[model samples]
Target: MTKHIARVLAAVLLSIWAYGAHAGDVIRSFNADILVREDGVLDVTETIKVNADGTDIQHGIYRDFPQYVTTPDGTRYKVSFEILSVTRNGEDEPWEATDTDLGTKIRIGDQFQLVSTGNHTYQIRYLTDRQIIFGDASDRLRWNVTGDEWSFPILSASAHVILSSGAQPFEPIAFTGSRGRKLADAVATVSGRGATFETTHALDPFEGLTIMVQFPKGAVAPPTTAQLSDWWWRDNLGWVVLIYGFAAVFAYMMFTWLWFGRDPKAGTIVPRWDLPMGISPALMSYIFDGMNRPGFTGDL
Candidate 1:
């Protein structure tokens, strides 16, 4: 059967009311749309929305910059597993496809399973033309997760038909998500009683992103992968080191100018205005010592 039908069955089986169910109960839906476009043409705009009771399979492949979406009750995820090989196809194309063993390192059979009991750091390196597959990785998933890493599809496989369709003003591509959901933000012209709202949102970096999604209620929740943030201002030792480094440089410059500077050591003598007559440090010391003595003083 199709992925959508399988997802629906899974949701039904999982949500069969084993006990009293509440609104917050989580369910998965496999055939949810997950792409969108902004109204403006200048940008590749897309917004993703989340509303679901279960987790499902969502897939997409695009060459332009990636757009992301997460929901209050639902979380969106992308999984990666990529392999490379070389092949040559033609001479007229100016690109060779016949060479085997391209730069891809991931093999088709290699699998990733994270059975972490607590928060753990993971290194993920994937290279694919564009495809996301997340499956069977969570349970032994351990860290309250049951899913495993997914497949890295071939380059020619566009996740959705929209990828190859080029850009259209009204056509927005969707990325399927969990639990009978569909989400995509594309360039759209809404016909209203009078006018339309056409705005564009910019693309974002694919790596190292921070997403804050609040639940229907105001919730301060973190991602499934707990990542901590610490500012440099909070690090006392770092601050101390920075301050000392600056101070050392300043002190060196001051000493250089006062003692061993060009004018002093290079014979570029600086004239001294002694006020014509003045007691030296040595002279002052001698005078001060004599005055302290019990001798008859200066005049008497």
Candidate 2:
């Protein structure tokens, strides 16, 4: 693989993850090999299995590179493949043409004229669309396995298709999911307290719509957002229970602080003490003044 193809492999792995944007919609099995010629043209051969039982599997290969996504069924579903150049043995040929969608065909004589739909799927050997193309054949190519391809869902149903006999440079993405979760404009309610490990569940080839997860560490298992509290109760009743309990304690404390136990001096005093009001300093002065019972003028 050329450096460009190597980088594109990373892109392809990510797109496989995006194919899982909607779970249960489609399930796919596939294998691909990337080839780079001395001319900077890239070729990819693939064998794909679609999971549409009794459903006709129709697929198209787009020569337009870099901006597309492939469906789970291995259909180049989104984006357009527009070819720019075609060459053979270092010589230019009139075989090259422009297309709004899939570019001119170099091998099949005519574009879309010989496009075939079969019972299962197709295996293209040199299924060329553009400089960047992927095809597969029933004849498996004994290529070297550089490393393990990563996938999710723990147990994944896989289909292995041979790439090319000779191995170029290849970089394998470790620890991939069976599919992936796609990010788009949507509403999501996050109730749990842990991290949600975002991963792609499967592979997509055409749309160039890839599922990429940003991890501080390279391709580790996704972090869980599953909260213990969330598993504890319906409506998060456990959380509610804790809140109510705290409130109850607080209310009790407030009541005690406000009224339950207070200093007698904190309230207004009543005038009905056992001691007569005249004896009290508050009224004694007035009472004595009013009594006018002054001591007999010095017994005069």
Candidate 3:
């Protein structure tokens, strides 16, 4: 039993040594900034400094989506990633992109030649729409930093996330290690109409740095005064004009009828009385005829 145990221990130590020896590059610093837009788009920028040991000619950086991500409401969404831009040493370098079964691989070098031995800086920008999940009560954003599958050990790592301007205020939560074995604190600040969360630490291979933030529902921007006025005219201006036009026409008809539409005889006053006893029939007839013929042009 003692002989078997010794052999097993030696083998384990050798394997550990071999694994450590194969670590090609070391990360000096890794910083990431994530901006959450109002339209559910997440804009991400990562700055990385790598200390290449001069072993390989070219370096590869890759981004892959998680198989599944669960929201606070137990709903799951398939993650997707899109790389926007990549730069090396503050200058645009030649890179080859390839789509593989695993994910996208971006190799950076000089004319497909080998990379030099030294500290190199790289910046990568990407877009992802699956990070922020909308809910009935609030929207939630889940981010995984170390989970991106880096092959090197990171000496220092930092991340900052800026929420949308219309998002409701809430505290953010962060976790570290496998299965979230440790909880980490983050600094939160409110600037202008949005909020930001920042944290910094170091990470080993396979260790995860994850964050989850909850914001209020309907975090979209409110309508501005100018926008409201434009919308009103665009949607309801015709109705308003039609109503006012109908009112003016009605007023004109009323005025015309009151001024010129009445009957001419309506203003005449006729006197009715009992004739005096001894009045001649001819005289009465003459008086009635004259009254009726006042406006009539005929032989008198």
Which numbered prediction scores highest in lDDT against the true structure?
3
- Looking at model 2, report the run of 10 residues with the lowest lDDT sum: 138-147
**Residues 1-300, model 1: lDDT tens digits:** 699999998888766752233232111111111121111111111222112222221211111222222335685322222312211111111111122222212221112321222211111212321121112321000010001122111101011111111322222222212223322322223221111121122111121111111111111122222221221222244668899999999999999888877563365768875432677866765676966755453765
| Best of the two (1, 3) by lDDT | 3
Global lDDT of each candidate: 0.25, 0.33, 0.66
Candidate 1 segments exceeding 4 Å error: 1-213, 216-218, 221-229, 232-247, 262-300
Worst 10 residues of 3 by lDDT: 56-65
lDDT per residue as tens, model 3, 1-300: 999999999999987885575467777777778788776668889888887876542554544445355557995444446778888888876666676554456665555456677788988888865456566778777677646466556666666777656555466666666555664734445455444544455556555567777777766333458755764564466789999999999999999998999667666689898878987776788677867654445786
- Backbone clashes under 3 angstroms, per model: 52, 34, 1
Better of 1 and 3 by TM-score: 3
RMSD of 3: 19.8
- Colliding pairs, model 3: 57-115
Winner on TM-score (1 vs 2): 2
Alpha-carbon lDDT of model 3: 0.66
Model number with the top TM-score? 3
Regions of candidate 3 where Cα sits further than 4 Å from its true position: 1-24, 55-60, 63-77, 97-103, 166-169, 179-201, 220-300
Q: What tens-digit string does per-residue lDDT give for candidate 2 at 1-300?
A: 599998999899867865454233232433444343322223544343333322222222222223234547884422223334433223332233344333233231234333233323323334322222222311111221111222211112221221222322222122331224333311112122211111233333211122111112111121134522332343356568999999999999989988967666666767773657447764665565747655333553
